[model samples]
Target: MSTWLLPESLADILPAEARRIEELRRSLLDLYRTYGFELVAPPLIEYLDSLLSGTGGDLNLRTCKLVDQLSGRTVGVRADMTPQVSRIDAHLLNRAGVTRLCYCGSVLHARPAGLLSDRELLQIGAEIFGHAGFEADIEIIELALASVRRAGVAQARLDLNHPGVPRAIVDSDAALAGASEEVYDLLSTKDVPGLRALQARYPGLRPETTEALTALASLYGGTETIARARRVLPALPALHRALDDLQALVAALPGHEFSVDLADMGSGYGYHSGVVFSIYAQGWHDALVRGGRYDGVGKAFGRARPATGFSLDLRKLSGGLPPAGKAQAIRAPWGADADLVAALRRLRDEGEIVIQMLPGQPQRLDEFTVDRELVLDDGTWKVRAI
Candidate 1:
């Protein structure tokens, strides 16, 4: 019934919140820059094939697609900026060494992915291309932590996992190989009964593999979890390597609260091949920042390279920060006095916000806080703080 109403989960950001979000965006971009991440602004829309390239099936499902009037081919409004950045690195830049890229913009989702998730998100992140060691993973995770600290969310919790852990366990067991998706869902949701049923299906599998598959459901919490995993999990090469990587990450991030969770896999499992992480602040129910190693994400672009990055919702991160101070406004009366015009121009040049009143119009204090007023005192124009 309301013609001017916004679509569900899509709403306008008014001036106050918009200003705060902008400030946070600038701060984050600056942080990324200090770490050698060059700023990149990818177009909001692109061909469906490229947008979904190497991103994963889940992204395709989340993207909002439309037919291009000029090309007659299906295109999609980006639901994520990572793949676009991957294309830039793999196809456009074609650089062999490590290339650091950062981006901040809105991505439209076909539907809200979570209860409070927006159809449009102001996503900001940094990606590192061409490094494939545990050191690269450590760097990105530390950078993400520093970003949260920079955003004023000091009490942040980091959760780390390697999807390879579960993949190794599942693949090692022949009976469970085909039903990995069902098994993953059960583990992700902590469905104990379903996992028990799964273990029952593979009656003749090796004791260690079966034990590890069932143990995945409970491998969560502090450093002790990693220790427990090393003890319980089979010594398969992939599984051991995943545990070692997680251990190395924990050792690097000293003085920060973190957990080793094998069951923390999400929809991006196929895309993020190693060392997944999510950061949570004290007040937020959802992750303030998330990323991990999606090495070889550039494969589809024809030159596969190791890549890892993290993104945070500007609005959500700003929501956890203290309110920003309002800019001081100096109210100036309309006049032809050369001195007054000169003073107004000087103030503007000095980065002051001066609101000039219209000729014969009344001053509206409600429109802005008049911190000061420009007036003629003793035949000389001056600015006096109220």
Candidate 2:
């Protein structure tokens, strides 16, 4: 094997894609700032328990764990930043009022999320803590939509789900006490046959209960799905509330494509105590963004706060977009003359790309195209078209 060969699901991000990802990161962070979201950066690696706090087994499995040499405790490369941010909110900031935070960093997944996904992700997201109302959920959702739109992604669709909807049904059957994981797996895929087979597996499970579970598989569409869910599913208050919450959110957010999937509530992560959402768009193989209300995410940090936020892989976001054009640069001859040095500094300060050539340097460029040149024309340094 070539020494330079990377791991199966990981690879280095090249110049063009890296540029696009960085630009998008800056743009989205600025967008979050416009909404008063303060930036926060947690370590790339931290104690496993802290990183996985309030999250689910899926995140644990995705995390790459190792023994820390300093403390001899098990630490893991962070697979998600939400929990770390939650800890900061619950323990560090300790603010009584609303606290908005945004983060952007690299996370390592133990394995590829999908065939096309890389093990390394440039995860960027914004979170709102200390707010419990649907207004917070709406803000998070609106921010998520704005993220992809700002990245030039068109026709973005919002898919909303509440784990409570499925949780209510799962809890209604006492026989399903320990089978929540299996049930989540089956429903997320809308596997009706699997739900039907559950009856035989758990003999005490009711036929009507299984039917209601199966009904959820077909209860997906536009706003009408919520009304249809009310009629088809059992009249459980918890279940209805979940549906109503979705309805209220839909009402709150208008002029965007919305859909509901009671069967697929996304990665509950064991912390999403309320509405969860995923953003999908054309050109991307998987969801472009995922986030929502997880009120108790801070509980594991000893202070549960009403929290809602969303995150997206900048690499994937950039991958779906058109190629980034090479930056236009001014070519300058190698010199340490005072005037030339001053000219170079001025152009750079003005946000111009200026490349200084070394003596006998080869004619090559990777990220910049030399469209203009700086020269001492008529004894005065000036920029001229190439």
Q: Identify the leading candidate in terms of TM-score.
A: 2
Residues 6-51 of candidate 1: C-alpha lDDT, one tens digit per residue: 9998988877778888888999899888888999999999999888
Per-residue CA lDDT of model 2 for 1-386, tens digit only, reads 89999879888888878888889999999999999999999999999888888777778888999999999999999988889999999999999989999999999989887788889999999999999998888888888888998999999988888888888999999999899878888998899999999999999998888999999988888878889999999999999998888888888877867888878856556778888899999999888899988888788888989999999999989998888989999999999999999999999999999989899968778888899999998878899998
Worst lDDT 10-window in candidate 1: 361-370
Candidate 1's C-alpha runs over 4 A off are 173-185, 194-214, 267-269, 359-368
lDDT of each: 0.84, 0.89
lDDT of 2: 0.89
Which regions of candidate 2 fall more than 4 Å away from where they truly are?
A: none
